[model samples]
Target: MVPTMVLVADDSQDTDRKEALRDLADAVAERGEAPVVRAFGSGSEVRRAVHSVEGPMVVVPAFVAGGDFASAQLFAGLDLEGRFDACPTAPLGAVPSMVADLAGRLSASGWTDGDGVVLAADGSTGQDERQAVTDVARMLSRRLGSPVQVGYLNSWAPSVGDAVERLQRNGRERVAVAAWRLVEDRDYDRLHEMGAASVTAPLWPSEIVVDSLLAQHRAAKARLAA
Candidate 1:
């Protein structure tokens, strides 16, 4: 069994995700218990990262929607024996406190009392993944004392435009979109064009997001001890 610990952040090939992964890796590298950082985008990158890591890995699913893609494409094929499998850590989203964090993002984006909110996410193909997004919307709705809409940026229905237009039709003077991504992507600017008055910042570099990732890493370490 290998003795070293490695941290992997899984996500798409988007530029912001790559940058955020590198930044997270650099931060992780400075700590005393720091594991090696290996990040992957496509299958080729995943294979390369796997071949280079000669140790147990804890995959931190950076995707807010879910980790199925990362689990299947990136760290699923690791051949660790007498050590932790390339077990993926918990998802970044779907936690109880995340609604508050997302609310904070909306407020930070200048969301007002009557402004409609659409919790925008990178759409997921899996039922559980989409349900996770819906769960977040419900919590945010309760927190803000207003109904929150769930919208997908890709791979699902109720697109951002649809949600925003529905709010407008409902007579909401303004609507804000709360982003559920690790970092702002190309779609962010277009969100404004979709009839949103404002858009929240991505989850990257936030204490909530970083803490979630590290918490997963620590949990993985605990599992190894067990």
Candidate 2:
């Protein structure tokens, strides 16, 4: 069966991360799937571009410093709530061991050696986030007997596009992006376009995750009462 095609739209015009996005696109193409990954510096451009395509497509916004407005506009333009199912979103702290365990699970579930990308947030410079990613990379490397690359959501840490570039530089054939914030359909679409698979921690915790869950629970109770 032909895999679904996806499009990635982000707002980073002149960054070096374009290489990573290209690597991701190549990975998807190699999967015998048709994924079209494209990046734009503005949500308006992406929105216009997507309308020209038919069938299902995913869009991912690059993590801008403090602008979710574009993301929100993208979501509205796409009517995401009506189009795709919402996956639970979670924020995770530095948990190297847990990440390693999750990597193992991904492997068991059919991720091939060096065919994975872990997306993490830019650890505050003095924080353990960076260390956690490094440790997990080491663990995954040992498990796969090959080096595993890490990507960051924001530009502060190594960007996801940058990590993808590094993997390409190392000649990795296929890659999957395991990230926390890629839960939205748009994000998933971005990964698909880049030719990278997307996965996240199941029990990872984050403010958004917690709030969404709680809201759901309350809604369920209200429905029951009604």
User: Using Cα atoms with residue i matched to residue i, what is each candidate's TM-score against the true structure?
Assistant: 0.83, 0.39
* CA lDDT, candidate 1, residue 178: 83
Point out where model 1 deviates above 4 Å. Answer: 1-13, 31-33, 66-84
Candidate 1 backbone collisions, by pair: none
Q: Candidate 1 lDDT, tens digit per residue, 179-222?
A: 87665556555677787899987766666666666677777766
Off by over 4 Å in 2: 1-97, 114-119, 122-126, 180-193, 197-226
Cα-based lDDT for every prediction: 0.67, 0.44
As a whole number from 0 to 100, the lDDT of residue 213 in candidate 2 is 30
- Candidate 2 steric clashes: 7
Q: After superposition, how far is residue 80 of candidate 2 from its true place, in Å?
A: 39
